[model samples]
Target: MNKKKWMRKGIALALSAVITAGIAVPPATAEANTGRIIGAIIGGAAAADEMNKQIKYYNTTEEGRQALFQELQEKYGVYYRWDLNSQLDRIFTNLTAAIGSMDATVYDRPYNYFINQQEGFNAFCTLGHNMSVNVGLYSYLSNEDEIAVVLAHEMGHGQKDHPAKGMKRSLGPTILANATGTVLGAIAANIWNGQGLTKPMEWEADNLAFEYISRSPYNPGATAAVWQRVIDLSGNNSANAFDIMSGAADHPSNSSRRDNYAKKLTEMSGGKVTVDDGDVYVNKKRLLTPAPAGGMSSAERAYFVMGNLAAAYRNGHAASAAYADGRTVMLGAQPIISCTDGDTSAAEIAALLNQIK
Candidate 1:
């Protein structure tokens, strides 16, 4: 086997063994040694530090996880009880088994994961091993590899300490707004709006996710394809540009990502593996389509649009990117404002654009 594949399998074996024995490898020592491996993902050390602080506050223990769980339940109408708990345990069990063999610091505590039943595809990772993937994402992923791609992507954020840095930089003030929103519903909008994360942070998550997956047996090529599936599933709408529903946050445009992944796959496979549509693998052994493209109609468009609008309103631009063009203030495309030859009301167009998205 090639060196990368051999090492990847070795790590996978080690990780799987660790998980089988119910062990966790921590990154604290590594963090100290590396002095926080926050490069290019978030903007700077300060931002990475802030994000870590937030993650530490949220995921240090069961109580903290429960507290955040409760808060999420109240806000998103989700329950952290029963079958969901069972599902998490199963996922944890498998993930632990898969990660134990690696030569890395294994922590005692397993990472915390939760799913909000929100309509759009969104997930985020916090420091101290805190991560959440939306139920909307689950509805579409369909397979273990796809799910692995998603989990690894989120895990990349935590492993790289992006959340700790990002939270410190952005979420601190947003927390205050969240408090105000708790009392006055109207305040939530403003609170979520101002606390959006930086673009670079998103890119970091994507690249790290790609890195982590590259080290795994599961195809790293699928990352971009999975993202494309998400885009197609949610319609071609870019309204929720920042929202990770379809879970493509911390990255560039879907079409752009597809192109980039294809190029990278070529390099990784020594020009043997070719990609098409950003979602298929074309190798000598076989041709594989990651997932089927369900027909995207106007109704689906409206569904994802509404989902994006909600995500935009709730998580601000950074969180709503999956469903619509969250990056642009306008709901649809670039040049945000549409001042045609005859029509007027630029401000109205912008406001209406928000509603429509």
Candidate 2:
């Protein structure tokens, strides 16, 4: 018999994809309702040991890892889109390198990723460095830096082992500790509705993601600007699957996320860049008076421009004085931003960029 039939298994962990998707997480009320049962099942230290054991088994063993991978592939059919997959590969490679700067463990087991046909804005990095991003991601986010931020967030989940912990926390440790592989597979099949990280866990992943992106060629400002665009496109109450920006039970509010990233960006800059009111300031001087552009509002547009300037700095394109090329503000050959109506003229912003540079 093959290994699949020769050995007994347990669906102790088929994590990452379900929890990170934001498809659904049991609400506070439901969590409260299940608390007693989960608490009883955990039974303190014994349960913790069992849960950790399972996490290790699945995250470290080839069989356990493959089982989880198979489970995910079965659930979400794969889509072969060479263009999207190629883009994802490039981003994934950068993220792997970026994550390594701070988290050496990333090299222990390199990440493996694929594109899932799930037509929504979602992605997940499960146990053992296995991840999948939905094809819909490219449809919603076009900026490579912003998309990199999203992938980094999912990798954040993997780095922290959030999946297995979340699964055990929500499912109750004892439940997994005792279930046979066959039974566990049954459980994993329908696990989408009620398993995921706690609200605090979600916040932790977001913070880690910001750190990862800052180390990359991608601008850290994309971290906050991403949420701003999400709000612009979907508003605060979006119910879309894996839409982490939605003000759902599993995630912080979109505005809260944006503001949090803004704070992080400021900290990363050592207070060199800051957003106040609706404008981005550099060296305590207004860089631009933002005006509504595209589908984004004035404030929303400001963050995008802020991201551009931050990218210019991150990528070392801000070494020269700024100049206006048509409506755009440029630094040497790098285009920093396009001027919008109801905003500072491109020439004036270019002058400010030069001063700030």
Candidate 3:
């Protein structure tokens, strides 16, 4: 056939021979290499298709279920299985019930969640409804409702079958699909990383999480507040290297996510907030100046400014007049945004926010 097709055929034959002869291929063999050779890696796009089919079949087995957990444990160590388990149990149970109230079939396999001792503020959901929340989550966020939103967002990924879709996007089948001794484990362990998801996927999860918390007892405002808190916690920067939840370069900016919830909250309250370029309109009044471009894009910084206003108003943090504290602007005592060289002064932003009430 063609050069590409001819190489794929030859590699497929080699793989078939390798399988038939029962020669062990270490799980990391292909992963360690860049896959420049046709025969060395899983054929290519055709091979990726085969890998997807294999994962589909493997997902139904008990081995696949346990293997993913095993790989996670091997990589992240066993679950904490301590006080955090009870807390995680409460979170998972509440989220499960909230989600199940809408779509009961989502629980057909039921979610199995636990805590890992990882210090990075992140959590993930993989194939088969298996999930893990990092211990570092508690360090940054103590509000139960806030934590619930994070978990619910991950559950949204599981509900939408994003792990498989994302895996294809991220690694393109590659060697992960053909891996032996629980390929799903290798898939889950390597894929579903914070960066694996697309912007649309992240937004979808954020929207779904807002819907879930809105329907439940948890505060829907946390959807925006969590990011507000993150922005506040990590000032002079838009992304935090340690905060894997919203800090990854590939992940949607926390400001973008926060702004979405902010708009939803406004709609829920019968108010209006619209965005154009990097500028924001609240109740048809344009306020909240965007930071000058240097680190975070003005577009993203504009959203964060709006999200801060939403959280301040919704959670009653805007009762006091906005004021500038040094280079940072404050909504009462809470920090909103900071100023840098060639950027809008923090005092000017405070004046903008002060016009709210």
Candidate 4:
């Protein structure tokens, strides 16, 4: 499917015209409340966590998912029926079954394939293990191979236990406790919350999906194209420009993903696969520089890294500077957009960045 299709699948239910539903996740109690609104810095992160868990439970049972899927279909109408592909169903089922077999893993086979009855171009997996692919995905996709690549990506999320072992608590508080030795120690509060998986996790899932599907009948070349389409769809946002984490931990940016795929392909193929246009493809389209096949752009990569480093450093996160190289690079430039200049507190810096476009 095209980049739009991936977005639709990622947010499967809301866009379905037939499904007259609100973007609701379970609410938190006052005690655990972080006093943030959905999509807001504090509130959004918590919402993401809840979204992942609640949605997973919502789609856990066959009956539950089927009912929800049907509701979405009816609400969104036939315009979004792109995800009803039987081939995709089979492929996703097979891939999930194999990956779910791990000893330390938890698998809900029924939620393996997410299909929203809407025409929007999107698909995504939540941190709670929900996979939703919209009907519009078919229109954007060129073939089963391309579609397979996307499915593999969703599967990768589960493999990494991203849905479960997601972001670390809070570096700020953790650091304080470690430094003070129980003097003023408390777990750092989780700041952001959105149901979808983080960018790094998304990349991990994509790579795992590539590795898994590469073993199947899907075309290997199509794998590279999967990332190309993501970059193409992302536009100025860069493939990894936005936040991909589920309100926890760090994620690799789009550029990092792009470079990673190139490195991986080289390693996997024993230097056979090169990052050239003909070697990698996007949406059935050929890449100009091999685009690393399943990778993101350099500028886009810098955005997320710099953004996160700045946020962590401001939040008083211990290793913030170690990861702040992205921001450092930006600050190093003639213009000098320093993370330190923004705010000394990690939370304040995070909030400030959150306010940026």
Candidate 5:
């Protein structure tokens, strides 16, 4: 048999083995298992082939691409405006040109941009090189410069082949055998999960976005301003111990991300950029900054810490047990802490840190 057929047979055999063992698996688990089995059997070439198939499936035609985008928007409760001559479209065109200047390969691909009525500050690029910007994002941002920063960031994902790479990692060789609905569902979920970009990939996109932003008329400081707003909106700050580790799953923490943009802006502008306390400054003047806020409650801290510990366990880290102990103490103290202002004492914080150590 050919390797592709062998891979399919191996996946079938693995499923049969599970059934013979009387082990019941959920559809999602079964789907994941199928991917793993195919990955183990077929390796890289097959995975790449599956990825290419998916890319072609999504990128074949404008109508097909729009249908896929419509399905995704429906799945995510996103309402999008489709007018080609709208102000949002104009901005997208300008940003696309900026991105194309940074990487000419973008011109060779079919890229589409959409404006969505999502009331959250977000944007993402799909595997087909289609992009979306949220109206809520526009409401939050102050100008076209900030909008360009977000657009460039999404374009960076396409420029770096992140979506295709993510599809390869996610679908493996299972794409050759899975039902269209199942594969599309997985793709939608992956898009929701930071567009299938890992934490490091998010930073890489940020860096690439800054590179493009530097060459354009927009100030690179807009990048830091956006992240600072994210931090403020998320109620995460330098003073929050739990929030410090919050972005380990999909993206870097707000502080780290803001610092990254600040550093890059400074470098690109030859030390003309200034970053301080979630504010970006240019030429001795404040360019953008969010209002300050108090720290989170002890209940919030406990919940966040529990989440962190749970993630650590899920990732199979050795320190999960230690963090679990810390979670226990925090949860046990929740009643007392929740009634008060939810402040964790310094000694209590130190004890939790020691336990995690």
Candidate 6:
């Protein structure tokens, strides 16, 4: 087949897979839900234990350490710096001490930190407690507090075993479902199960980072400021369907994250949170303006109203009721870009909206 034909076939296959998986499975019984909850708890513990064992083994061997270092240098071009007197080193040491004071258990882990020469605002923590901060992160940060915020977020990924947990969550359900001899069940299991977990994980990591930073001398407002800066730099006009759908799939919108951190800062300060009197996006769509009576635009409101109705149907509401709700709210509003008036049936529209979810 030609390249274009092969690519078209590939797209078809992927969409087919998604639609097959998107078919709603029967809701689990209450007992099943409870059992699954217990299973998840036990599974989480086992996953954590396994993660720690792996980290310990990796760090204990000279060959393993050398392999890890080589991989970092080769893959990412990161350099290990040992200058204790350097400014970056001094800041790193102070931040490390602050983090250690907050959680001695994590501090005692076989953690390794490195700096990269990359000129981008980025940092990451590996499954084995290895962390790297780019030079651009330091250059961009306004203060030590901001730097601490970035470091703490990366540490949060390690301390919470997010990488391990993500691996488990991604693989466990599909494997189990496949073993039960139901291909459709396996697909649905992976799709529905993994779909909602990622954003929560990011939020959990942020919360963990905040907890650590709050106990240190660093200002907790740095978290909010960092997110605000991200929004300012992104130059994203999020008043569109694609942006909203994409935001829902992965991390929460930058605005939502900034607002969350700002709320935390307010709680820490024992005061009311003052929201910025600027444009605010929700789910990546610029929805609201200044505080007083600010609300979503007609198209944005219609899109979400349709989205919620679709969710209601998926949750076992009557199709008639779901359509009724959609029509009641969305009929008067301007159509969302991806959703236009057509010969499309209610069922087709519901399916499309559910895909957005």
Question: Candidate 6's error at 220, in angstroms?
Answer: 1.8
Candidate RMSDs in order: 20.3, 6.2, 10.6, 20.4, 17.3, 21.6
Per-residue lDDT of 1-357 in model 3, one digit per residue for the tens?
886676555444433222211112334554233233433544445666655554453344456555655555556654565677777888787887888889786677677677776776777776666788788777877767678888888888889877666655654444544433233333434333443567788788888898777666665656776776676666535455544444234676667777778778677534645556667666677765466453345655665555455555655667788998998888876566677775678888678767854
- What stretches of model 4 exceed 4 Å from their correct place? 1-84, 97-108, 112-114, 127-129, 159-196, 233-236, 239-255, 277-357
Per-residue lDDT of 171-290 in model 6, one digit per residue for the tens? 355443322223223333432232223777778777877777666655555676565555555533333222211222466776786667766654543341233444322223332232
Q: In candidate 6, which residue pairs clash? A: none
Question: What is the lDDT of every predicted structure here?
Answer: 0.43, 0.66, 0.62, 0.41, 0.51, 0.46
- Cα-based RMSD of candidate 5: 17.3
| Residue 352 lDDT, candidate 6, scale 0-100 | 40
State which candidate has the highest lDDT.
2
Q: Is candidate 2 or candidate 6 better by TM-score?
A: 2
lDDT of 4 at 188: 15
TM-scores vs. true structure, each candidate = 0.49, 0.74, 0.61, 0.47, 0.56, 0.49
Candidate 1 residue-wise lDDT, 123-207, digit = tens? 6554346556667665566544456666765665555555445434543444323322111111121112212344565555566
Higher-TM-score candidate among 1 and 3? 3
Cα lDDT tens digits, model 2, 207-291, are 9888898787776778887888787777764454445422225666778888998877666555666777678888788776687
Q: Whole-model lDDT for model 4 versus the true structure?
A: 0.41
Candidate 2 local Cα displacement, residue 76, angstroms: 1.3
**Candidate 1, residue 12: how far the Cα is off, in Å:** 40
Instruction: Give one clash count per candidate, in the order shown.
Output: 57, 1, 0, 52, 1, 0
Q: Against the true structure, whose TM-score is highest?
A: 2
Q: Candidate 3 clashing pairs? A: none
